[model samples]
Target chain A: MTSRRQLLKSAVLGGGAGVVAATALGSLGPEAAFGAAAPDVEPGAPDPDFAEGRIRSIKDNTLLVLGSNMVFHNIRVVDGTSLWKLGPTTFDQAKPGDGLYARGVRMPDGVLAAESVWLNIVNIKGHVSNITSEKIHLDHKGQEVLCHRVAGKSIAVYSDAPPSADLSLLRVGQHVQILGAWRPDTNEVDIATVFSPH
Target chain B: MARSQPTDPPIDLQAAVRGEVSWFCCGTAWGPCSSTGKGACGTCNSGNLQHAWPNTSDACWAITRPDSCGFALSRRTCGFQHRITALCSGTSVVTSIADCGPQTDLFCGERSCCGATCATDRIIDLTPAAYSRIASLSTGLRPCEISTP
Candidate 1:
């Protein structure tokens, strides 16, 4: 089977490189790829490396974010920093109250020199209340959410197993988690992935 | 249970603790996020049974700084299994630590209440696959219990 990892590689690095990588690491399971051990850092310290949270304030190009843990982050967006919302976007589009996840080189002064910032990305836990070739209907916390599947983009993983491009594994009343781009101010989302334990 | 796999173990309920959970995505469908590709763990996909925890490594812990908020999370490495249960519906899903996230320190005192149930402290962030398994992506945050299986 064409594992989701291979499909992701192909999507990001092109088919040739993806195939090469797939062959090079064929014996390993997907989890094995993330199992490498790394050195430890100080306890209770700000990553000085990455940041995620709500935008508390924005002044000039700097964003003061309050993280979910109550930690504050000063994220500085440079020309090289990439921003995304429903799709690729610019920093000017960011607003207070927007949620963001940033990855960057932490400056000695403690500001996150953001390399990339994603806005309003959400992962929801819901049940596959309904499904069709084009969309999946979900009941999340008693609210209805419409998830549209993009061709060649959305995929699924079953019960900690390797991910596949198949959505056939999905069924009504089946619990699932969907990771996707949230369309701001709507009850809808673009499904990027679906996870089910089948 | 429709497409049941007999090989998979049963979901465990004994390992539960209440906290707040949210969701995030990589390999986006449009715009700049689309370039996010995978994640810190190259294998992270929105559709996979994955999640981001406050403490996945020394480096990750330093970043999330859950200690600043008085939550001491153990250093769990990538691919560690965690089962999150949504308090609103009691629905649950098992996910692996795919990356670091939901900076516990930022929302230290924050609480999410659903009916009579309320949870505080952002302890975990789920991939869409994991998050959608128990709650709505639109709700953004939910009260949940996390336990090992």
Candidate 2:
């Protein structure tokens, strides 16, 4: 298991300016806005195919997964979400080989150092409250929150929650319902049927 | 035979959580919705609402109902690699992720403010001038590395 303290220490000591965060768990502030100051163009656009992989190993907060393309990926799942069934509070209960999808800085070291990694989750929902580079920060039930997306981004299943409801019609103030798996460490929330009022 | 609340269903909360049931999704692995913040985006400041965040290393916990800290789910979006570095001294302006050859330490030019302009591993920090170049972006060249007290 990776201690948050070790992860923090290594972020500064292990190398120069190289931060390998597992998901969005860093006290570090925002990365100077790429487009905030300068005009931006879509360079390697955020591919919906943010790669899917299986957990190959766990090093501290780092998770090395075997990407579908045969590439080994090191990731960090943010420990938070908008769904309840996904999980909460810890990463110990998670299993490797489960699918994952995420985006962040990729290191030449073949480690896909993540800002956030989504796990296989679903049928959970919530409202967005704020935005920052550090986290897709949320306010679930008044507690500081984080989101760990699961099993790629498209929330795609249902057995409980509202079956006839689609997760698309949701707005910030609008109420929502969700379902899926969750892990507490990477605070990433995965949704399968984000429901909302039309 | 026991009766249930009119507003609440007669299902076991625990069973519903553990049961393999329906699941909506955000699409992309780490679904980025109105999805992010430094530390303030939940149900901590609203009224008439039940906030929902993902479950962490353990079980899913709910937020206070009627807190106001979340935004609309659809109106949030960004596609840049926001990063953190320790190489700032008096010079380098650092930006998103830079790959250091398989575990080798590295740096991106002094605040390569834009991700497109940066050459991965192009700028480094080990000398005085290097620090000055970086510090120039936010603050004038740092005289020397300050140690945290």
Candidate 3:
């Protein structure tokens, strides 16, 4: 019989590779959803340098990247060591409008524990949000949804359908229908629609 | 009891947010909900067995006892599942939306839950006694989307 540890190790190794392959394949669906007639690059492009998208959510140290159109990308950015800053240090300064990138291992649960976060310069639109140093929170229909971004900053929307953007624009007293994946592993919602006034 | 092949009924699901969480109207607040689609007909027990179906034109469910209802899945799962219990004609039974586990799946697979999918579109997890208490007056409405969450 396979030893417990050996079995676990094997599962991880297989699962790790499977995750990479799954993300690679999963992104393809969005590429297709966005009407990408054809994508030449391999799954997720394996771009070590950078992966940018709106702030879907931050759980632990993972960021779920909603690529162009509806493509989903899980970015992990966490460093266990004390020396490393580990993931995005400026969680409070991160906002749905701000573009973000991180580097981490992709877990089987469709989340990424990043080692670092890169805030890209972009235009995103959102309502006024009370900011703090730890984390920002927004009121969606009396629901205090958490947010990330610098306090007292300009708001802009890069994509109307961006789950992050839609989540930010939600009215405190209005109803917002949500249809997407909440990858608890990464602590993010791969939002598809925020159900705005069509 | 024996009933002819019936139809699935539709259910209404209410959405609410408590403090910071958003979820559907559940439990006693909302009526019965299950894949069988029909409300509980109060026919499940030691002798009066129920027949249900977890999947149909109804809401999703998670199997709590697959063995009792009868299933053959290799691994146990919990997300959305459904089941139906058949009783006397015009009195088919349905299960409510409930968190199912490995043991539940075992029961479901055996045929303890709803034997076949009901015509109702919602789910009800009420027991036979509870169902008999309120099922007489509660006829489910047609299935419709929440339009808004």
Give each prediction's DockQ, rounded to 2 decimals. Answer: 0.05, 0.03, 0.02
TM-score of each: 0.42, 0.29, 0.21
In the range A45-155, model 1's lDDT, one tens digit per residue, is 223345666788899878998865467899876544556664557889999877777654455567766545667766666667899888899887577888988877777
Estimate how well candidate 1 is docked, as a DockQ score: 0.05
lDDT of 2 by residue, B55-115 (tens): 1111111221101111111111121122112232212122211111110011111122121
DockQ-based CAPRI category assigned to the predicted complex of candidate 2: incorrect
Total backbone clashes of candidate 3, pairs 3 or more residues apart or in separate chains: 97
Give the count of colliding residue pairs in each prediction.
40, 125, 97
Any runs in candidate 3 off by more than 4 Å, and if so which?
A1-145, A149-169, A177-198, B1-80, B83-96, B99-149
Supply candidate 1's per-residue lDDT for B17: 61
Ranking by TM-score: 1, 2, 3
- lDDT by residue for model 3 (B1-149), tens: 22121232212112310000011211121111111122222222210112222332112124222223332222212222222222212222222222211122211211111234222112223222212211211111111111111
lDDT (Cα) of model 2: 0.29
Model 3 TM-score relative to the real fold: 0.21
Per-residue accuracy of model 3 over A70-169 as CA lDDT, tens digit each:
4466665322200111121344545454444333333456554332343432111122245344333334323344434322221222222222332344
